[model samples]
Target: MNLTWRSSSILPRTSRFYQKSFRVVSTESRKESAQQEQEVTHDQQRDPVLSEEKKARAPFLKNLFLGRFDKDVLGFPELNKARQKNFNAAIAPALKSLMDAVDPRRTDAEGTVPDSVLKELKNQRILGGTVSEDYGGLGLNAMEQCLVAEFTGSDASVAGIVNASNNMVIQVLFPNSISAVNKYGSAEIKQKYLPRLASGQLTAAWCLTEETGGSDTTMLNARAAKTLDGKFFDVTGKKIWVINAEKADLFLVFVRIQDKDELHNPCDITSAILVEKSEAVALSPCPSAGLRGAGIQNITFNKAHVPVEHLLGDTLDGNEIAFETLANFRCASAAQVAATMRGLLTKTIRHCIDRMAFGQTVADFDMVREHLGKLAVWTYAVESMAYLTAGMTDSGEYPDTQMECAATKVFSSEKMWSCLSECLVLLGSKSCSPKEGYEQYLRDSYCHHHHGGANDILRLYIGLKGLEYAGKEMQALVKVMRHPYDNPSIYMKKNFRGLWESIRFNKDNIKLKMHLYGHIHPTLKHISLQPEAEILERLVLRFPVVIEHVLIEHGAYIPQRQMLLRRMADCIIYLHALTAVLARASRSYCIGLRHANVE
Candidate 1:
């Protein structure tokens, strides 16, 4: 008799696991939209990041990670009465009905979201949440949209659909439709696809990877040939790892465009073309260990013809649009991961409380409590980071959101992986069943590291971006030193400010105290936590020294030094997470939620 690892853990089903660990859970809504959005989304306020000139400048992470302690965004956000009502009316019921109805096991076995569920989700207006109502969509803002993704992350099949839908809603349809058409596409292209995408008449798949390239866009082998008429392009190539490949009506294919006149190694430019699935666009289901309900797939395009109007942007701008889309998609994916951890922690805590072991509840055990504590801390941190990133983008508060999103993605994705393992252990024998959610959770969580951008590539991106910012400052100092005699003012101004900062920077660090309102009630705006918050605050404020140390040593070539950069990037990721947890803890404290303490 062959026994698998999972089978070995199925301890006769008569143990404590049978009654407590297998319980399923259900999943919330809108703002009195504006008030709920008060923390970061003040429409009347202008964000400096919205300005292209200021956006070109890099932000000093010093506020959060040393030099100064910025308290403006350090606390959890408040959800007002209006926002609570808004959430209840628009989002809560729909998600509850959906989560309770779908069984991940069935979806996994079938490898597709059932048509009825998709239709219901469409009716709920979830797919169009990020699109503007003017464009015939629900037009929920980024934070709200990410909030839904968080809830959807609880179940495996639901998580996949939510993840896929989020990329399309936030990246493809919302931004690409507007940016590509208004900023880069011809008017003819804008009119052709934007409305259709907004209204959900045609769903889209973002296909960038191919046999020759995954992260290296330069190596992509797919090519497009322009016909003499200039009205259409004949495309030919294969693309892999396309989300929603089998279901989407339109394919956003990233390809190399070169004139048919050039024959040998002639691809010179990267571009995007929308292809319709047919015999020319052959899709095969690349079902994976997880996200099976999403129909994760690959496609082979055999000389598919795409309209000239379907081209996304100017050839030069295609890569730009793709990278921007990737950044936004990554942020959304991280938010979902946070939600997944939230759900896992919730159910595991419930299981521990209910399951009796050695004549006492599992929660009575010290090890069990410790695991739950870690999960809670991680969940809060990730939730804070994910939503804060969303708020920054939606509110236009952070111009350099790319690195923040990437860091959040890496941190949350990896943390969520650990979270799955912890939840499985706490669930005991119940987790060993194939039908139990943990098996699916483990499989699905693997994609977090690979999707949007692989953790490795994103880590390099974090290091590279940071180095660019560091270069500007270092160059300024160098310029002052080189011209000390020529411009005494330059030398004095640079050195004196530096000297002043050094004088103020004491070795005994104290948090810059400020009142923050993260909860709906303003009277108790300064809710405080214990030693954990203080530790996290200190760590966040000190970690910039680590970044500074590594940058001083490695400089611009940090991108090539992958291993060292990864360590630096991880440090950034964890520091950012700590800040997030601190902020989230404030919210939890104010709202009177359990485990608000990051113990």
Candidate 2:
């Protein structure tokens, strides 16, 4: 093999370029060119690190893989009584009046809410739902913002627009950036945008998703390089499909900000720059099938000059911000789905009582009752998942619930899809008509499947996450097989850990005949769906065994089997969502909040 070496100074780092081993053939022509250079093909490249956070599941989530669906192992995130005041005084009331004044059809057609209504929304502090009071925000926690998010649920576009601007930027992203800057950036950077962001004066959009690589933040075309003076960065690149783009005053653009001063560097270094939408930034609205009110657009930054103060956190903090925001976005998406499903329930019940069929009210029909019951269960489950997640975050039990959040989003969205379908079928042609709000709900509901990470992609996360711990164990076993004589202690756990755990678990299982009875929260003990719900619990318990077996059988090749992973993802979502419903029901029963109960 011929080798050539170049100085690190002159050599440029290329993206995803791998050197292939040369092959030799017996033919004279092949043998002659055996030492020929391998041409580098500029094919479609992928950044393995993009969305890398989704590659592995958190250890807490690994318990689910072990057949411990009882989330109490995760510190069993519950409602904290301390947050009652904030919920009662600000969040709940605001949600009650949220988006109530906006006409869905008119907003859908006109692509904007009434100024009067937006003013009312702002005045009520619904717009500042996620912001802290110090910066003129409502100072609500994740749970509080979730309540407000649920209020926006009736309309997907409303939720997308509001959540994108307020929740995505200020609620989740801004706070993280501020903390990072305070810890890493200068004091001036910390104080720069909080007030502007907290108050409704300035709106920011997340510019992580690009057309070339959708939701792939690693392959960013936009980049920033240090200016010769070392005071500013010359940022350039186009951002597409940014939520609230046209209306945004500030943009949180994700790109790789080059740092030449560092001695040693890690891979996957990206930065978030707070770019104001000035003349340097050109924006054009991107028309969509739904979310018209969101004002998503394609934005171009023609060498936008960003000062050091505008850089978010330290270098390489961009991925953290992106993932944090994405996690928050997933939680908000579930809340939105809950609200949407509830809205459908409200319209359905009202219509059922009013409309007549066979000279009898639709409510009197058995099929209607069945459909409504299913819808009610689904809506309850979604609301449960959303609130439980928000409460989990607020309680600070699981600060990083990447798997749980993604699971909630996928579950809620799929449920919402089924919900709207049933709603449309139940509503008949009236809903099929252009004027009905159901049409709008159906359109907006499509966003759930595609945005906040697509369900197909997210499902792979669930399947893999559930198998993460097991795969690690498998990795240990493989290592031991490769070096059997090296260390008995190292391979001991790999060799017999499962057997011992299974024995211990089986003993515990035998000791406790009824798993659901003891695990059920006291608050939820009163609600008796035990016969059916318990069946689900037991069946779901078996998932870990299946997952363990799959991981053992496939070993490291499991990632390539995304089709199987997606199916496993579907199962895990339903199981996790079911448990979330139980958790939410227990919380509601404890708190006496009837707003989120099934029966």
Task: TM-score each candidate.
Answer: 0.78, 0.79
Tens digit of lDDT per residue, candidate 2, span 162-251?
A: 778765666433353111112333456535666666666676788877778676677887888778898887878888778878667888
Give every collision pair in model 2: none
Best candidate according to lDDT? 2
lDDT (CA) for every model shown? 0.63, 0.64
Count backbone clashes in candidate 2: 0
TM-score (C-alpha, index-matched) for candidate 1 = 0.78
RMSD to the native, candidate 1? 11.1
